[model samples]
Target: MDKKHIKALRKIVGEDNVYDDKAHMIAYSYDATRTRYEPDAVVFPRHEEDVSAILRYCNDNHIVITPRGAGSGFTGGALPANGGIVLGFEKHMNKILEIDMDNMVAVVQPGVINMDLQKAAEAVGLFYPPDPAGQDYTPLGGNVAENAGGMRASKYGITKDYVMALRAVLPNGDLIRAGKKTIKDVAGYNIAGILVASEGTLAVITEMTLKLISKPKL
Candidate 1:
């Protein structure tokens, strides 16, 4: 990466959040697959705006931006193969924004852990059932990106089944909201569906609204 680009990234997210050192790059290089591809830099986006600005700058400069979660996927989806910057969300964007019992829904940032949501839902007599093998360690954003399925998938379905809506940033830095929190949304193209399992090719998901269900009797 050029010095100007690095400086610009620091300006957008802050000096501390941008790491261009070899150690940081190496640390963020591999996923569960164990394959390594060191990125030019590893960036921690504190919010949606940070992500937008970073992406806008990167896009304009023709730089690669790899959106990463917990690095728990076997698919190596989180690997910074092309080497630009790893846009990591686990830093500050990991939060369960809301849990609406009335509507049986959840609002969450991309960095939320899968099991965290499951436990939170269970606490309220609800269930968020997609339990990938790495649920205990994987982030919800990675699950959604991979459309991951678990042992319970035969009965409960996979990650895409629970997704209600998605807030994502396009390659061109445009922010878009797709799908609806309501149970039924037939108003537009199934953009959310396309994004799910796209594996970071289409856009970077910043937040997600997921549908919940009554806790299954044990």
Candidate 2:
């Protein structure tokens, strides 16, 4: 991107929020992969709108965009194959909006930590299944990106199954919604399923509507 673009982004997210330092870029270069390469820049968007705008800018400039979440991926999913923009969700958008006990669901941002959610749900006698080994460090968005499976998967299924809906910032910078909360609604194509495993290839998930299960009352 040009100075003009960077300047605009800095205005939107502030200069402190944007990092072009070599050291910072290097740290976000690789994930759980053997391959490694520094990103041209790293942008931290605090809100869904900011994420959409940044994605739009990158797509317009033909700059590759890598969506990063805790950098805990195992298959090099977060590794930047090409030098481009690396978007990290660790800093902002980490709130868990609500745990809907009546419907058995949780509304959370992509950056929410797994254990935190588990703790939150347990407090309400509910549970968010799909307990991956990376539960300590992995974020929900990254888990969804990999369809992350764990020991409990045999009993509870994987990330994809619990993902009822998501708000995504697509490659073209257009904001889109995939899936829905409704139990049985054969709407448009299963675009959400396609986006989940794209691993940053198709779109970046900003928010998620996950299905929760309350503890069986005895």
Candidate 3:
């Protein structure tokens, strides 16, 4: 990685948000698997536009980018296979954007924790049923990436079933929105479906709209 490229990335997110020091690089290198592959640079983006800029820069420069969440993934999706850039979402993108009771839906950033969303929905008498074993520590984005499921999977289904829509930035720096909030949307190809379990190879997920269910009176 060129120093100029590193400086360009620092400009996108800020110096404080970019990491390249040996300590930071080593820290960002591993996931739950404990396998380490150091990235040339690690960036923590706060917004979709920031991600767009970074993706565009990397794309133009032919640099590999690994999108990472809370680092709880067992599949090593967060690992930077090639020494390029790792885009970490845990710092600034972890927010539940909306909890729409009427629609039984929640719009969230990729960094939102799975357990946090569950608690928020339960507080409002709603349920987000895709609970992985590491729900308490796993980010929703990683769940979606792995299409993870847990004890309730036989009854409730996996991550793909509940995801209604997604906002992702493609490798070419094109920002695209797929799927819709409506309960029954068959108007076009299931682009969002293709992305659900892609494991960060296709695009960088920014926001997700999850379909919730009414809390069962159990």
Candidate 4:
């Protein structure tokens, strides 16, 4: 990216939120794969609007963007293969927006930690069943991106099974919402299913509504 582009990005997310220093780039260069390729810049967006602005600018400039979560995936999904911008969500967007006990659901930001959601649900006598091996540290967004499965998958299911809806910013910066909160709705194409496991190629997930179930008796 040119200096002008970087300036524009800095304006969108603030100077402190955007980093181009070698150390910062190196830190975000790799995922659990351990293979590294430094991105030109790394951006920390605090909200969906911040992400939208960044994506819009990147799109107009034809800059490649890799949306990243907790960097815990065995696959190199979070790695910046093409070397443009690394959109890191861990620091600012990691909030569990709502734990809807009545609906048995959770509305959360993409950066939310997987185990944190599990524990929160368990506190209410509920469970979010998808538990990847790295759930302790992995972000829920990464799990959704990878359609992660765990030991209980045979009995329960993977991330896709629990995801009810998603809010994502497309490569062109257009924001879209897919799926619905209701348990059963064959209203249209299953766009959310297509996005799950896309590995951040198609869009950047900003928020999600996840299904929950009663905690099984031990």
What is candidate 2's lDDT per residue for 74-159, written digit by digit as tens? 78888877877788888888889888888888999988988888889989999887888889888888888888878888888888
lDDT, each prediction: 0.92, 0.83, 0.92, 0.92
Better of 1 and 2 by lDDT: 1
| Segments in model 4 whose C-alpha atoms lie over 4 Å from true places | none
- Give RMSD (Å) of candidate 4 vs. truth: 0.9
Q: In order, how many clashes per candidate?
A: 0, 0, 0, 0
How close is every model to the real structure, measured as TM-score? 0.97, 0.94, 0.97, 0.97
Which stretches of candidate 1 lie above 4 Å from their native place?
none
Pairs of colliding residues, candidate 4: none
> What TM-score number comes out for model 4?
0.97
- For 25-85, candidate 4 gives per-residue lDDT tens digits of 9899987779998999999998999999999989989999998887878789989889999
Off by more than 4 A, model 3: none
Query: Which 10-residue window in model 3 sums to the lowest lDDT?
Result: 68-77
User: Relative to the unseen true structure, what is the C-alpha lDDT of residue 137 in candidate 4, on a scale of 0 to 100?
Assistant: 86
How many residue pairs clash in model 1? 0
